[model samples]
Target: MSQEKLEKIEKAGFVLKPDSPEIRPNYERVREAFESRGIEVLLAERSARMIGEKGMPFERMCVESDFLVSLGGDGTLLSLVRRSYAWHKPVLGINAGNLGFLADVTIEEVETFLDQLFSGEYRIDHRLMIAGHIRKASGAKIEFFALNDVVISSPVTSKMVIVNAAIDGERFNSYRGDGLIISTPTGSTAYNLAAGGPVVYPLTKAFILTPVLAHSLTNQRPLVVPADFRIELDTEKYEAVATIDGQERYDLEEGDVVTIGGAKEGARLLHRKERNYFSVLRDKLHWGERNW
Candidate 1:
């Protein structure tokens, strides 16, 4: 109720993925809490569609908001982070699914978390992002950004693709598989982890290269590279598709190239309290824990 407390957060925005019927009650609870603190709340298009309410565009939600809340799992946060990266807004992820890395805050803790937020008890964790582009054989190009990873895969077409990767114009590897994952440190925990890639520290400045169902047995392991390196993947055997943050996709043909690099700006994430990295791994992933 204090003036300073009210001033701590002026304008807030929420983006809810899936926009399901079950999430409405919890959404109202969080909205009322924000309004009680004198914070102006905005909803994204998906959230707007559910309540017969009009919401601002996703890009405007990023630019206009003092802070943004993501209500869903990690995938939802990834979508939010990618869209909000240009505005460099801080995001708080209210996990609506299983245990998540970025969406660490639980729905049950939203009330307490807001109190901690207003009290200056939270810390901001900045995570790196990756930008990529696809250049067709005809010279046309399209660009995209991803907070998690850029995946080049043959998820369709009923055939595996041969993808050749290069680093800074030098040939790196000739991989024949479903595809390859070029992930930021934040994304190292997502598809990258499932593909046998290393679990990089979220704060690290690095990119991970992990092959998906690689055909060759030798010398086909995941590689970690410095952030400064530029990576390119070109396919010439079968059709491939470039997917950004699992949201956007582009078809890739023979001789098409996709270039990836560290983005100019990173994502700023808000966490209510300090959490140990190793402990998070143990709790979220059951890392280093034995069932026996």
Candidate 2:
């Protein structure tokens, strides 16, 4: 990052979830590595005793730290990003699980990356996020922020849902499907892609709406709109749920309306300067491999 764009980082926030015994020792080793460089590091939340002392909660740690390091899979990093986006904290992902799409770094490589991190050999990717506001029939209001995607589906796994979606208050499309996905460019490869949505470039500023298993409306494909477009979703008939990043879920009764749009703040993902989106995609997906 350029000098002006980079914030002075002294204390690093660690987001380690589940507090497992096997990962504890590695966590301590990483913490010691950070502290050795005169950078104070704290766990984002309390952990297993094997990792030693309990660190502060996520909110406190985020506010106190110069930046954050997520030690888990993509799901864990997404949760951390959603909570810490308000602080605009740049987050580094250390993959401790399988198929870490967002958590792109391995535990073994983080030490080397830390040296480059403090030496100004990194870049910050400002990825856009989405916000979902729900107005229930009982006058209750709920709001959520998601770094990946917000999904709405039927309570029963086998049942299909009737969803009416409008863009900017204009009539758009209605679907009879299992669910719908409102994703950001950063989330194009998530549920959106699984449901046949286009794979948008991570840097693109757009909103993608993809319906899951639409009935009758075979033409109801994923819709990509400008980031500023306001999307309204009305679920009728079946009991449904609004799922945020697959972590937080809220039950939606009949007649509930959900408003989704671009969040005021986006997640800041930190990466080594040499890391390229296409290169990562190719390496992870085996794009150039031959079919023997």
Relative to the true structure, how large is the alpha-carbon lDDT of every model?
Answer: 0.83, 0.82
TM-score of each: 0.92, 0.94
Question: Per-residue error at 68 for model 1, in Å?
Answer: 1.0
Model 2 vs. true fold: TM: 0.94
For all candidates, the clash counts are 0, 0
Judge candidate 2 against the unseen true structure and give its global Cα lDDT, from 0 to 1.
0.82
- For residues 1-292, what per-residue lDDT tens digits would candidate 2 score against the true structure? 3333456768888877664657876677778888888889877545534366776877888888888887777877898898787788888888886646678878787778888887878788878889779999888899889888889999788798888899999977888889999989888888898899998888788999888988763688788899888999988888899999889999998878999988876688887778778887777768898999
lDDT of 1 at 22: 74
Q: Write the per-residue lDDT of candidate 1 for residues 1-292, one digit (tens) a residue.
A: 1112222488888998675757777778888888888889899886788766688888788778898998888888888888777777888898877768888888788888878887887778877888888889999999888888998889685478788999999996888887899999999988999989999999788999999988777768899998889998899867788889888889998978899998887788888666566787889887788889
Pairs that collide, model 1: none
TM-score of 1: 0.92
Specify the highest-TM-score model's number: 2
